[model samples]
Target: DAPVPSGAKGTYALTIEPLTAIPLYASRTLTSSDPSGFTVQTLPNDRGLVSVPSTSEDLSILQK
Candidate 1:
């Protein structure tokens, strides 16, 4: 997670990986802004994960 400077625009990236079949969710709250505004975001409807095979040599050894 990251914070944007006051009166500045920025972006943040979030990643989640669930080994099980269960669903995953994320949430964040911005207490205050440059002008003292509050914001919040919940990720049940905005977060997801993708699966990829291990192809790196070191990771392949661990898998075996």
Candidate 2:
């Protein structure tokens, strides 16, 4: 594992299977009584945000 110090910058590459979708609240029920329509609806706290910046530079040279 590579650790970067505070105020430092680094570039890294990772290869893995991309995430499709996550099934949330698929295990337990949500309500106390008569959980037919009023099933337990829970929302987890906001974790983080991610985005890929749009670039106009051609990256075909990196393929080979």
Candidate 3:
């Protein structure tokens, strides 16, 4: 887990892994239940990595 700064915004990187050892397409889409709290940023190539921008208010409550 990542720590969200108090009253600040931060980003976290998420690594996507395949269930099997098969080659998959590079283009993929990600979604979040709370779009306002978490935003997904996809990277280039099929590295299976994504960036998530999170808000302080959204993460603060998680610690409670």
Candidate 4:
């Protein structure tokens, strides 16, 4: 993880690539139950992720 300087803005990209080709045969559809209109999501929400600090931090404080 890379942290931007405090009080500064930074742009970063986080990418994930699988070693095995994702099976094109597997797929699923998600739809909202609301009857007012049509709403659909075609992809799963689980994008592999990790939590990290947004700015440089004094992690040593944790040792106290």
True-structure RMSD, every candidate: 8.0, 16.1, 13.2, 12.6
What global local distance difference test value does model 1 have?
0.64
**lDDT by residue (tens digit), candidate 3, 1-64:** 2334345556644466669898644333444555545444435443445566885557767789
TM-score per candidate, in order?
Answer: 0.40, 0.19, 0.24, 0.21
Q: Taking the tens digit of each residue's C-alpha lDDT, what string does model 4 give over 1-64?
A: 3333345566745444456887433233333455644433334334567766688778898999
C-alpha lDDT of all candidate models, in order: 0.64, 0.44, 0.51, 0.48
Pairs with steric clashes in candidate 2: 30-40
Ranking, TM-score, top scorer first: 1, 3, 4, 2
Residue 12 of model 1 has an lDDT of 55
What does candidate 4 score on TM? 0.21
Q: Considering lDDT, where higher is better, how would the candidates rank from best to worst?
A: 1, 3, 4, 2
Decoy 2 TM-score against native: 0.19
Where in model 2 is the C-alpha error above 4 Å?
1-38, 52-64
lDDT for 22 in candidate 4 is 70
The sequence of per-residue lDDT tens digits that candidate 2 reaches over residues 1-64 is: 3333245466733323336666433222333444545444333434445566787988898998
RMSD versus native structure for model 2:
16.1
Q: Model 1: per-residue lDDT, tens digit, 17-45?
A: 76899977677876774588877867454
